[model samples]
Target: MSTSIKQTASSTTNPTTTPAAMPVKTVVITGASSGFGRLACKAFQKAGWNVAATMRSPERENELNTLRNVQLFPLDVCDRQSIESTITSVMETFGRIDCLINNAGYGAFGFLEEASEEEIMQQMNTNFLGVINTTQAVLPYMRKQKEGSIINVTSLAGLMGMPMLSLYSASKFAVEGLTESLSHELAEFGIRVHLIEPGAFKTGFSSAYSFNEGQATPELNRERGVYKKFLDNMLAEPPKPFGYGDPQDVASLMLKIAQTPKSPLRNVIGKDGKSLMLTQKLLGKKRLLKVIGNAAMPKLSA
Candidate 1:
């Protein structure tokens, strides 16, 4: 079941009143219940663009429902049916989709050997395949319009692999590769593809994180203690300095990317993200790996 609520004309100017030459733009955002997705909805709506904020459960949401020109629709990127239904509903409500933001994903943290098959599949399905599903569902509509943008919210982990977040990083890396390729493939149709790689931000992402420890086998269980300690140290003090920034900055970047035609293909946002990317570029892979190893497990490296 899907629910969409829009503010009345009293709260917002009627779209019909706008000059026919300049129609209002519309954006569809996934994972709109919290974090960057939620903020992006507000940013776009504030910019006078219609916002279709899609999430898994729209009935439970209260905040976005009151905003002008912002509607909530139930959408699960892992489920193709939900994606199709939500896109259809958004088109019905707003008439056109000028941008699509694939921000629906979660993190699964654990060593690769300890991760269960279910965990691996779930991580890949939601983080990687989910983006693919949502992007595919919207392509036809954007193609018909002959001009649109798809902005994918990936992580800095996508660029540099984090030990405990191997699966999560892999999923994001897949998105990075996919979006880079699609930029070229979709250019002819006037559709632009972009990637927003953000570092740690003050959001619910950490709270939503899933950890895998019980999935380790009896033999691997003994070794899990060592891995757990390494994970703990990494979390307490990461190798690369990352300071959490306001998630709204990421939301604003998404809006900028959507509105700017000649925007760069991949944008690395946040102070920590920029610093880490620059470090990697200067030090190269081998030196960066050694630095990460020393920082993550100083005693062991020593």
Candidate 2:
């Protein structure tokens, strides 16, 4: 993909330049094409912050132009050269970026045994490596200014285990660990970072996930397919906790964290996610293991 940085100077003044010393809080977001990324870009733009919404394909970007304060930058996080160049262009146009949201990622779903090596790497490279590259690119500016925020988007799978989602879980688990460690290390430099762990919201992520091999593993597929009836019956009790979370609900929470004076190191995004975490905390090792084990797939009888 060809990358282009269309830079336009704002008649709007930078607070950093003034004696009043208003912080020039610009943000650079990766994966601005869709999902939470798209919603976040608009939300920040509406809040009157200078936004650089970087997508893989900028030529096809007419939607972002409609927004008043967002600049569209063509950035593919997987390409190191592209990431570097995009960072340069962002620096040139905006002067300094106060926040870098590493939001570009796709889910890899289905049974692990059927997933290929290539599929796993694709998910990891984009989900985990992309965050690393973007954070490294922004570190210089944030360090020079000695203040910034890096927000990493993880998932409920990042915290808890689930059936048929091992690869996806691994990728998010990596993000959880990465952000948890970096939050402490970067605090000393006047740079603050955060992680957002969202639950299953209807961003179409589940449907969009890459299945191991859509047609492979016929037995597993058939078992799950017919057993869908069993699970549906199991769920038909007095109903569980809350239902699917709205994406805007999580997005609003993320915005609050972004705008707060000092955001927490980790912002858990859904009621269900928060509930699960509470249970894990209260239950501790033994009970949690039993709960996870019961839901896990049964071993084949040898």
Candidate 3:
């Protein structure tokens, strides 16, 4: 089933046979190999939208390829040429990309000291630069069409500073700022920019993430004693009482954003995501830092 995401355009021009006024809106999602991107591709495909699902390796995403409405494209957003080629290919086939979803980022959790500068750059490249590259490609199409949407997937960590996820947070924070500024610039073009802030979703994002290489070793106070135990507990196995959120939940919210006449520039989804945003937004940064510091404090006495 495909979701009909339509845009009302007045006329068609040139070699580009623009889609119907109530045209089958096309969606291009990066990182569709897994997680939210996969679910979203399926959701839109089922809803009848033309979905171009992209990943670094199309062969690896055979399952996603099985979906009827989606066309898999090879994309590595970090690569300038690959990003450009992808846009050309998609436009040649799909005519226009009504929505571009930037969902291709992974967590690299570690103390800033443990993570190398290269690692930090890699995180930012995939997480933040990826969006910039894709948006650059999609802009001209939307400019001509005079309507489009750019949906960015950011994390709660982006909004509030977290301990171990420093690099990840930095990357996402860049995305938050990038999306905010770009939104204002694109609005005049009749384009909408939205950021989806999700909590810990059960999309294997945690397991897929890499920790500081040697931090897990048995040496150098790796455990850090009781404090380490607490950190481990926080990152322990799932079956979380509330169950890590569903990717479908985020996908559903994406559809809501698409359908709504005017979507909030920033949408925080899931109870946990909303809760985090509330805490960070309501409690002054200093106060929030105090709470976090208190929570991560080691029991020096013990």
Q: Best-fitting candidate, measured by lDDT?
A: 1
Error of 3 at 118 (Å): 2.0
Q: How close to the true structure is residue 292 of candidate 1, measured as C-alpha lDDT?
A: 65
Global lDDT scores for all candidate models: 0.86, 0.78, 0.81
Write candidate 3's Cα lDDT for 226-267 as tens digits.
544665676676534455777899998887786675999898
- Candidate 2 segments whose C-alpha is farther than 4 A from its true place: 1-18, 21-23, 214-240, 285-302
Model 3: CA > 4 A from native: 1-21, 213-232, 239-243, 280-283, 296-302
Q: Give the clashing pairs for model 2.
A: none
**lDDT of residue 177 for candidate 1:** 98
Find the 10 residues in a row with the least total lDDT in model 2. 1-10
Give the per-residue lDDT digits (tens) of candidate 1, residues 187-291: 999999999998878787756888875477787654566766666664554335555788999999999999999999999998887877788899997788677
TM-score of 1: 0.87
Candidate 3 structure lDDT? 0.81
Q: Report the C-alpha lDDT of model 2 over 1-302, residue by residue, as the tens digit.
A: 11221121233355244334375578898988888888888888888888899999988987987888789999988888899999999999989988889989987756677677788788889999998999999999999998888889998788766666688789899999999899888888888888888876767564466666644576676655543444445334422466667877765665677778488888887777788788888998568757765654443331
